[model samples]
Target: MSIKGAIKGLLATLASGCLAAAVGGIVVYAHGFSALASLRDGPLPPVQQTRLFADLAAALDGLGVILALLIVLVAGGSMAWVFLAGRFIAGPLAALRQALGDHAASLGVHLPREEAEDPWTPEGLGTTLRGLLELVASREADLVASEAHLAAVIDAIPVGILAVESTGYIRSDNLAARLLFGQTDPLVGKNLSALIAPPVHPGIPGRGKDTALDMVTRAAQTHETLAVHCWRDPSLFPADVTARTVSRGGSLTTVVTVHETTERRRAEAERAHHRALVSAALEASTDGFLVVDLDGVVISWNRRYYDLLGLDSDVVPRLPQAQRYERVRAVMADPDAFHALYDRLVNDPATTVVETMHLAGGRRLDVFTGPFRVDGVVAGRLWTERDITERERVQADMARAKEEAENALAELKETQAHLVEAEKMASLGQLVAGIAHEINTPIGIAVTAASHIADEARELAVAVKANLLRRSTFESFLETVHDSATVLLSNVRRAAELIQSFKQVAVDQTSDERRLFDLATYTQEVLLSLGPSLRKAPQRVEVDIPPDLMLDSYPGAMARVLANLVLNALMHAFPGLPAAGTRDDTPDAPREAVGFPGCLYLSARSLDDERVEMRVADNGVGMTAEVRRRAFDPFFTTRRGQGGSGLGLHIVYNLVTRTLGGRIEIDSAPGQGTCFVLTLPRRAPEVPVAAPSQCDASGTLGGDSTV
Candidate 1:
């Protein structure tokens, strides 16, 4: 039962006991008085009556005194009961009211002042206590839910999180912390120093050796986030740890947080490596390289840059942009131009400029300037300079040499022309001598016949004058005259034919005129003209050309080509044979005695409507492979000092290929007679007639050559 209810029952019990005692006392006194009155009235005299009355009066006084005593005792007992109730019940009730008010105040609820100050009542006190208890229960539920949410949020964080106490014990840890440590067991209650190591410090004993507990204590005291290294079994990684002190129920606790930095550290290492590589490349370059930012500040430069400008390396990097520019301009031949170029490059960052720079010390440099970009955005400019003084000097020397070579070539060509003209005149002179010798034979026969006829005629005239001539004698004279006349006419006609052939051959050999001529007819004429030289040689000539084959080409060049081939064969084809115009001592000498009776073969045929093929071959000791390879080379010969000009076949090759628009090839081997095959166009290319002295050895006289 409640204290107030128990006290109420006790007060009621006391009141009932007092009332019962009062009734009992009244009954006892009245009963006693009645008995005394009955004894006095039954007998007696006046003396007995007076005595009884006095006794009755005395009894009444005593009864009244007893009743008064009873009243005093009862009143005193009630006063004592009231004092006990105030001391035990009302005092405790007042203390209970004060406690309830304080709890309400703590929960931010105010209680009315009258409620605390009023006299204690069980019912009022019970109602107030029940209302305060219900409000406390509601607030407790909200606090539990808030704590659960905060724990979930901390666990969901990706960074490793650890809440450690000041004594290094792990009070709380998240999934990230467990994963980072590579652990599956609970981390709580474990010493933080056992899970993670401190940062390493070389060369300093005991430095950076602080345990996790010590670090946490220090961090809490200083209110700072400390960076440290943590161990995950085999390797150590970077981490940031922070600690704060919190008070819970009058006790101090520290909350510590840890964050890993492995990726960030790796990225920083990679960037450092790349920077080292770029620095090495720049230093290795031979050219001067410099980089400047958009604000005209020097960002970087290689050693070559300072070396090229003759500037102090240690001082240049510390100088301002304007001062650096001024120092460089001092070494330039044109300071104004250098300043202008710098301004232009800074203003137009996207443009690439290349130009030459002249130094005051007579040095030339090739300079290139372009944008330097970072992350695809133009942030600065780059300059590259290379020395080119030696290159320019070499180029000037080469130009002068080229001019001198051209002048020498022109003089050589003129000399070659003179030699070619002289050679042509020598061949013509030979042709004239041969024709004169042929004409002399025919003329001698004609003269002999005329002399015989003159003798016969004189004899006939003498007989007629004497008038004594017989008929037989006159008839003999007439027959003799007719025979002489026939002999004279035939010889004179032979001489005239020889003169005409000589005239045509000479003209054709000296001029480069184009004409249409039959192949067979021209070949025969050329061979006839070379008769003097051919007859003197031991070799014989052969011809096999189509009579109807025609060509509209340079006949003069053709004749010269034919003559050179025939003469070359006669001179070189037959060895171990007597020289020209000389004979063996033995009249009956076998053909083998003259070194294999050589024969020169000349053949031609029409290849197509616009082309022809010609062959000049010999059946004598042929040329070797080495000799034939260089047969068309200028000034090459086997008989260099034996009256062989070596130009005989060379001239022939040039004339056929260049002047006549043909190709000539040599086919020969030792002891297997040589053959020169020529393929020519029927209508030669139209070109200016080159003079004999103007033979083009380089084959540039005509458009193109196939030799």
Candidate 2:
């Protein structure tokens, strides 16, 4: 039973307890007092008459005196209890009744309180309560059903769900709601207004104005359904509250549903930010990209695409997307297949490329169309186009120039071959010149000797015939002719030796021999070949080649590489200081170095029998850091024309890096001359060996050489 019931039963027992005591006192007094006679001077009569007369008299006095007092006392006491029970009864039960009555009165909602205070009285509000209690007792089934319906609704809510009456009464709240509010039960039937803490600001609503109070209040007043959100418990979480105000039988109430939105809102914000980032990235792209739907709607086109197609966005937005796309379609190089292309783009399951689209301003675009998917289903096309017109122009220009270059290169190659031939000729010419010089001396000597021998013979014959005597003199003449004859023969043999040496040098220079040879001898053969060009300047030739150095290499290639480097230095570096446009700089030396005579040195050492490292260096002007940066760029030559082919170094670079499996490096400065170091590896480095082995010229080898 409720505490109220137990307390009420105790009060009823106490109030009745006093009445039972008063009645017992009255009963005991009547029995004891009635027996005593109050007639003090009375005489006895006959036995039967006296007994009857005496009993009658005693009864009358007892009745008038003590008996009467006892009777009156008992009656008065019983009457008082009957009257005082209503007033002296314990108040808690009555209070409960008042509470229950208020609760029932505001069953579906809170009610506007009456202005007057209720002076509780047994005859008035008490009578009304008793009748209601009797009715509840009479209809237990209906009351139970009402209670269960309310309880069931309260149990179902996972989140905090609450209902409040318009008068600020707590109508109902679920277990979660009570726990969230940190309370045990609803303040059932408590005056909602009395229980509510006053608003933070007087006359103006604060938390009170929030849904918990406001919607209930407003609905009660206006009889409208009001929905709102509020935080019921600030400590646990900011509750996403949805409140719906309602009215029932002139009573107002509001139901509140509180949901937690922390995770969901966070996820939504993150996705939104990612989408913004993607859009920004697309807009910032340099490539032209656009999207089209299966229905031919122009969805998104990057700014570059707009510019590429020469489209005005302001004009495009006014037209239907289909019309705008029609305008865009006109720019497709293959517009005839645009519709088909679009269909394919939307339908294709894999990536593919579409080529050469025409555009405004005589430009060509490269269109890359891909499928746009929505919900895992292909929806439309995402086309990315680039203006490849410039690339085409570059290709065309390169093709023509390449044709001219090839012809020129062929001619140059022919010239180089001829120069090689001329080199052979120069070798032969050196031989011829040497043979001529040596043979002229011998031939002159032989002719003079022969003439002298004839003279001597003639003299001997003349002397013998004229004199006809002197035998000693005739013998002396024969000896003189014999000596002169010996001298002539010796000179002829010397001429033959000179001719033989010339013939040998001429033959070896052109012979493609793979056999190991003396470095000094091969280098001399190369020098002999270079004699034709050297003779022009008549420059003094220095030969420092060691005779014992041996290597097995393509002598022809070695000869050619050396020739190119030497000729390049001679023709390019000190060509009169660039005719005043690029006068050579004699810059200061580096702060720390071996010495100040910035120079290029040529030397060779035998790495092995299979390899020889020939280093060619010069003392002319050198190259700077900037020059080295673009030094290897294809078709990017510092020497514009000058018959450079630009490919001179490029070809050299390729030959060393690709054809020969070697490295070509250039080290130079403003004043310090350039050194082209060719590291030829007979036993090539461990790399993937293709027929034409490619090398990375950019790879730094050993020590920094200030290249």
Candidate 3:
């Protein structure tokens, strides 16, 4: 039974005994008093009465003493029972209550002092104690669950975790801690110093002397994190370790957390390398480079920038943006303008500016300024400057030279035109002289025949007048007159024909008139005009032109082209041969023109309805490849001092190509003879032809000749 139940039953038994004792004492008192009264009223002697009273008194006193003794015995017995119960049961119950309170306090549960002191029945106390026990049990169960959850959470973390003792032993370690150490066995009860190196604190006093255990012990005492190296077998990797002290069951334990930093370290290293490369590239550049932050602070600059600006290296480093600008502006030709431009650029970050700046030393610089970005944000502006003083000077010189060249070229062109006209006039003079010589012979023949006719007429008249003339004499005189008249008429006609041919050829050669004419007839006329020159050439002339071929083009250009080709061939083709009617000692003479017989072939044919092909070829000495390539170039002559002007073929090429709208080509080789091929349009282009220049020339009707 409980202490409360046992105490209650003992108290009921004491109450029953006291009530019985009270009842028995009251009955004895009543009976003794009644016997004394009867003795006093009855016929008994005084002495006997006195003795009976004494006996009654003594009996009552004895009864009173017995009652007192019984009472004392009862009280003493109850006290003993109470003391025994207090010593055995209450003491234990009180102790149990105190213990329960302490246990509840430990479980974060508190019981009131009034509840412990309250009067309690057996059932109430038993119920209270049972409830307290149940609460303690629940708290213990919750504690167990919380500890298990905490352990699971610690294990689930990716970073290594360890529960360590101050003595450097590992009480417990998570899976990550074991993995970091490359071990599968439990790390519990192992020394932490064996698995990893001690965390180094370079800034701390006496750091080099501290061991792994000492560092860990210090961390537990100070509760600070240590960044250190962790040994992962062959290498040491960076890690962050934090040790904190925790008290459990009156013992101090340190909880350490480890985080590896291999990837972060690698990323830092890569960034550093890239920064170094950029710095090197900037330093090696020839152009001045400068970078400034948004706050107008100079962030970086290359050595070239200092050189270009003539800045003091030592003082500039300590200068603010404004002061640095002042120093730079002092060296500029326009200080105010430079400062204004700087302000404008700072205000408008998005604008790119390119301008020229003049320095104090007469040097010109090309400056370019643009915004630079970092991570898509405009962080600063980059300035680049290049010296261009030498370039500007060169450009100025070139401009002056070009103007002078143009003036010189104009003068040369005018002089060339005069030379070409002189050549034309000279050619015309030669033709006139030849034609005059040819006409003189026929005219002299006509004169002599007329004189003979006159003599015959006179003789016949004299015979008739004397009256003695016979018929036979008269017939002879008439026959003589008739024959002389016929001879005179034929010679005069031959002279007239030569004059007409000369007039037509001279007119065509000097003008650029367009006309529709048969190709064969035109070619024949041209050859006829050059007959005087051709007759003296060593080569035989051949003409194979088709009579039906026609052209509507510049007849003057065509005539000039034909004349030049024939003269060029006569002068240069046959070596050692005298040129066209000129003596061997003349300025225009050939070289060694005796061994081989020569032929000059002139041919024309219609290539298509719109075009025609003409060829002037020679079977004498041929031109070399070098000469052929530049055959039509002006002022290029093989016979320089031999009186070859070299303008003959050049003029022919210009007239045929520019004036008559034709294309010309040369086909020749050493010892193989030479051929000049001309392809011409039936109807020439209608564009106005200009006078001959150095490279290009054209001709117009009734205008200056393009020679």
* lDDT of every model, 2 decimals: 0.68, 0.53, 0.69
Candidate 2 lDDT by residue in tens digits, 1-707: 33345334534533222111122121121122233233222322336333533453454443342100101112111210111222334354454445444544543322223335242433333244334444443454566787899788777767776677665666767777666555677645544333233344244344554534654454455655333323233433333455566777777577655555556667878999998888789878878877767675777766787777878855763578668768878876667677676566546645566777775458988878777689988777777878788899999999999999988866755554554355445445655565565578789999999999888778777876888647787777778778888899999898776566445545544453345556567666555555555555412334445667765544544555565566566555554432222322232221112122222234666676566676666555666787665565434446676655443454455445554467777777776667677777654443223322112244332211110
The digit string of per-residue lDDT tens for model 1 on 1-707 reads 33344434434432111111121122212223444434432343557534643553455453332110111112211110111112223443343345445545765755433366323432343244335445544665676788889878877987777777666788788877888787787689988877766544433123366766777788889988777777777777777778788886576777777788778778889889888888898888878888888877878888887777778867885799888888989999999999898788767888899999999888888999898788999998888888888889998888888888877766655555655676788778878878888888889988998999888878877988998688998888778777877888888999899888888788888776778988889888778777788777766676888788889988778888898888888888777754443433221221122233556778888888888999888766778877876776656789999988667776787787677888888877777777889999999987535532222334223322122
* lDDT over C-alpha atoms for residue 378 of model 2: 75
Please tell me which model should have the higher TM-score, number 1 or number 3.
3
Off by over 4 Å in 3: 1-97, 109-137, 151-229, 233-258, 313-318, 339-352, 370-380, 426-430, 437-444, 447-485, 571-595, 620-628, 644-649, 688-707
> Per-prediction RMSD in angstroms?
18.3, 14.9, 18.4
In terms of lDDT, model 2 sits at 0.53
**Candidate 1 clashes between residue pairs 3 or more apart in a chain or in different chains:** 417-693
What lDDT does candidate 1 reach at residue 299? 85
The lowest-lDDT stretch of 10 consecutive residues in candidate 1 is: 76-85
Reference-based TM-score, model 2:
0.53
TM-score of 1: 0.69
Backbone clash count, each prediction separately: 1, 6, 6
User: What is candidate 3's lDDT per residue for 260-368, written digit by digit as tens?
Assistant: 8778878989989988898889888878888888887888888787787777655674689888888888999998899899789877997799999999889899999
Q: Give me the runs in candidate 1 sitting further than 4 Å from their true place.
A: 1-138, 184-186, 201-229, 236-266, 336-353, 370-380, 419-430, 433-440, 443-492, 566-597, 619-654, 668-673, 688-707
